[model samples]
Target chain A: MRSWKNHVRGELQQRDQTEKLPFIGVFTSLSQMEERFEFRKTCLDDVQSKSLDRGGREVGKDTRLLQLQLRESEHLAEKLSQTVSDLTTVLYLKEAELQYWQSRVSHFRQEALSLAKGSNAMKATLSEFEYTVECQSKELAALRTEQKGINQALEQACREKEELLQRWMEEKREEADRLNKYNAAQERWQRFAKQLKKHLHNARTKEFVPIVTSSWCGEAEMSTSVIQRINNTYRDTTMSKL
Target chain B: MADDKDVLRDVWFGRIPTCFLLNQDEVTEREAEPYYLLLPRVSYLTLVTDKVKKHFHKVIRTDDAEEMWFEYEGTPLKWHYPIGVLFDLHASNTVLPWSITVHFKNFPERDLLHCPSHSVIEAHFMSSIKEADALKHKSQVVNDMQKKDHKQLWMGLQNDKFDQFWAMNRKLMEYPTEDGGFRFIPFRIYQTLSDRPFIQKQFRPVSPEGHVHTLGDLLKEVYPVALPTEGGPKRFQVVIHGIEPLLETPLQWLSEHLSHPDSFLHICVIPVPSD
Candidate 1:
């Protein structure tokens, strides 16, 4: 009886160690604990039956021993009840902890799903933007090339216009210089013609007066005609200047 | 010869090819031919108009043909202004003749109707002149007749003196006759400038002086209503090809800065922060 009690105590100690390992270890140790509980119940029943048989054979001598055995069995029953209560308390705590962990995992999963959806939307917009940027850049390059060609043509036209204007100015200056020279020459010629006309008139009056009184009418007419002819020639030349 | 510097040289005038009709409805392309007048530069437009009238009378034999006036591209020309000034203002070259249209006096609405033959029209016109002449006294008629006959006395006057005298006395001599009307005619002149073409541009009003307008004003004038208004501020950029952006510049200076006579200007506009 003493050895059986010691064995039961050792078994209970082993179950406690197994239960304390972790929540996962608790499930494996649950079947072992049940087996030990059943063994303890049967051992108590056998010890009670042996105590009854010994009381009938040696009533006076086994009375004190039987009473002591009764007290020890009661003590063992209290210890088993305490251990069972402790195990129930451990199971409740483990269940509550498991429920909390499950809720946290579900919340994390939902957050990940939402973040993935947002990433997909951003990627779609990014690709569209990239395509538009590429097309615009190509168009810009073509436009720049055309603009360069136009600028070159404009520059050439401007240069040609400037050159033409310069040439026109030079020609105008030459014309003005020629006009001034011609005007000066015309003034000199007019003065010389006037002096020549005066000399001819004086010569006719001073030298031909006596000749004219004689019958030299034909000579006088010829001189006058010659003078008129010369005057006509000078007038014609002056008119041409205009 | 004394006023030779004031003489007009290389002047040009325009003549309508056919007799002008008094009715606006009778105007046609056939009469639109612009003939170059071969008059001397010193000759006045009045001489051109008189010559045109004589040619029409000689060719058509229509005694009651209405009087005509000259218009250049719809602007009526004054009879006294020298044709040279007109040529200078409109045409760069002196030789090219101007284009003109001849409009008749009160034809479509009033005169020159219901006449059958030349004799009847002549008789009617003669009776009107006789009636007008009879209304004046014999002494006044003699004085007017002598003045008309002695036009050659003043014909050799210088152009400036003649123009001034005519400008002042033209209204005095044009007194209404017994028929309550007067006879007047105009002659148009044109000269085409092939080498130097004139270009004019009007800007949108922007300031109190009315010289400049914003760039948006130009865009609005060009495109009637294509822009959409948003709640936010709208910004746009203009890019002129071969030139810098033309923002915040005075509208009066825009044409001078961007334009040359020979080259074509290209412009581009872009909107900012498009949604």
Candidate 2:
């Protein structure tokens, strides 16, 4: 029994040997120490239980709020899902409209390009026509200038012709005057010739009378006197006729 | 037509000297000189009377008392007889200087229209004037016939109607060639203000059909230098001094319009204003 007791003391003393606490080693009896240890354990157990109860109460409150919030989130998620479906349909329709607009824009672009080409051709033709008009106007101006030169030359020629004509007319008038003078001089010459012929005839008749008188009678003085009287009468008559 | 041909054959023109003796009573011997003139064979004695009046330096008065009539030798020559016929009868051997005397009725002695003595015709002044009137009418007719023939010839020549031209102009071209064909009558063109004297161009004896000759062609031949060098073509104006029938006509057509007794036609060239 003493050995058994010693063994128990040894086991119990073994805890003291292993533990270095002064107060714990100062315990009078093992039962009292055990009672104190049991009391400490009980206190620790109460504290742990109270703490556990407080944590459990808090968790219960959180779990209830979380449950309500989870329900609301589920409802919101369903509404959001419907909105997404509707938005997806709208996106599909808009994509179709966008494709139609893109096709129209392409068509309009082609029309604009063709119109631009036509305008460019028209501009070229208009420029060519304007160039032709400018050339024709220049040609017309040249022709007008040439015509003016020709007109001036013609006027000059006419002036020269007029002067020539005036000179010719003056010469003609002079010729006519000379012809008149010649005719008058010719008339005076003819008159002189006629008078000379008359004189010669009278002289011949007077000589014949003297020859006859001298031949018939040798009375020279009387014959001479009669011939002189006859010559004088003949001269008077001839002068009277003239 | 045959009669016209015969008359053309008989017609002759030559220069003759004419004498006028008007103041025979005042001057015992009127020694007036003679003036030369061209006369046709068919010239009337009335033409002689006119010539005498023209040369006498006396105004020809138609009034009976103041008028003068012509006498050949001592007797009054009848005016109705052609000068050629009278020469054939009275003086066939006489050459030129055909003498004629003028008898004025001595104004206050006796009225020429109312003379009484008609046997000798010394006072038959009124009868002589009437004969001269008839002769003038006949001469006018003959002149008109000749003018018509000339116009026909000219028209035919201008239009190049050779047959008609030769038919009408055969008598005018009566002088035959050695080949027994007729020659074209020679004509001349004289320029007014040109340095060259004259241009002698011959008319075609026979013209081709559809050919026409104008004064413009004649001007081109005569005044080639007057043509335009540049600009529009030049036009020439032709004027004739004595022509009255046609003015500014073709050259050939102008031949018939020449004055009486003119040997050749005279033409004046002028430039027409362009404007």
Candidate 3:
């Protein structure tokens, strides 16, 4: 009995070792602990084995889940790289278009400057042409004025010439009248001289008493004598029967 | 037409000294040739006035009567023979053949002033104007009036140089008939001289009216037709007629020329018997 009692006391003191195992270990009350202990050793061993198997299977399933997460990360990196390449191609095309527009704008500015210079040159030429036209118009107007003045002078000279000719004709008529009057007086004087000669000849012959005849008769006799002398003057015998 | 004009130019401008243009009725071509030949033979011609001298340039027929008493018109109102005609009862004077171109002791250059052809005619049957020549001129007038046609005779010739003609007056008074005026009788007058300056005043009845006019009235009109005859200086004790049918009425008197200085006829102024 005594030996049996000692064994019980030692087992009870070694209870801590069994408490770490099994289905229900480390019970608070000693009675249960004792009951379990008294219940059977096989039952405790079966429970420990079942615990080990469950822990190992759970660790393996956790490793398979980590491998699936790594494959998903690699697929995401490939898709991001393809999207960046596409963006670079689109930027290059936009830069080339900007350079072409800059060149075209510079060429258009140069053309505009040249056109402005040509326009200024044309404006100066037009001003010179306009001034030449003004000078020509002034010269033509002066010539027209001079031509009119000369025409007026010519008309005045013609009128003066006509007036002078009319005055000359009147003077000629007066001269003709003067010549006629002188001839008549000369004829009258010649008749008186002839009669005196005839009377002197008759007195020298001593034919009759000296008596003065009519003054008109002596003048008539003198006229006859003077005409006879004139008849005998040129080609004296030419007009004998005068 | 151009050729005809050239021919006429030759005829008009041709100037040989003597030229004869005879009407075919008066002279044939052959007869005119002789006169052209004779033209050069006449060396001298007598002229009474400067006007007459121009007509007879170098063709003179006589040189004896170079000095004579005659008168021509002058200008500026000198004294001219305005009225030397005799009235119906005026005196008669006889003037000798006073040559207008020449004269005797009474030589005068003034003769052409009164008569153009004074040298060609004598004033025989005229008024007795000079005391010396009046008695002889009166006797000569009485002898001239006895002839039957004596009254129609040319008593004197007066020079009319302005008219370029001679004024031949009859021995009797003659009437002048102007178209719109009253009739007037003009008796011919002449100057006469005999011894020294003897003058006689005598006149017979002259122009009697025919159509109530006198015989002398008709003679005045007829004188112009006969005075141009060649025998004017010779036959003019009377007015010598060359045309036939003596002057009762002078009408249509065309010239029928005979030989000059010999062929002579007389014109009578007798009273016509009352109808």
For each candidate, give the interface RMSD after superposing the true interface residues on Cα. 62.0, 95.6, 99.9
User: What do the candidate models score in CA lDDT, each in turn?
Assistant: 0.42, 0.45, 0.31
My TM-score estimates for the predictions, one after another, are: 0.26, 0.20, 0.18
Q: Which structure is stronger by TM-score: 1 or 2?
A: 1
Among these predictions, the greatest TM-score belongs to 1
Between prediction 2 and prediction 3, the one with superior lDDT is 2
Candidate 1 — which pairs collide? B98-B190, B206-B212
Give a tens-digit lDDT track for model 2, residues A92-183. 64675467558768977998999999999999999999999999999999999999999999999999999999999999998888777666
Decreasing TM-score order of the candidates:
1, 2, 3
lDDT of 1 by residue, A1-242 (tens): 24422332343334223222233243336435654565566666665576568757534546655755666677679889987975675566457546645765786688788889999999999999999999999999999999999999999999999999999999999888878877786787678778767866875785477575776656656767776887788789767876
Better model by TM-score: candidate 2 vs candidate 3: 2
Task: Enumerate the chain B TM-scores of all models.
Answer: 0.30, 0.33, 0.19
What are the per-residue Cα lDDT tens digits for candidate 3 across A1-242? 33422332343233212222221222224334444454334443544455457756434434444544443444446556766764564455346435544665686678778888988898899899889989999998999899999989988988898898788877877666655544454455456446656655654444333234333445445655655675456334334422
Tens-digit per-residue lDDT, B32-91, candidate 3? 221111110001122213323322323333442233232212111111221111100011
lDDT for B180 (candidate 3): 17
Among the numbered candidates, top lDDT falls to 2
Instruction: Give the per-residue lDDT digits (tens) of candidate 1, residues B1-275.
Output: 01111111101111111223222433333333332333322323454455455433433324434555555544454433333333234321222234444554443322123323333333442333233233322223324544442232133222223332222222222322322212211111122322222222232224445335544455455532223356745454343311123334433223222211111112333343255
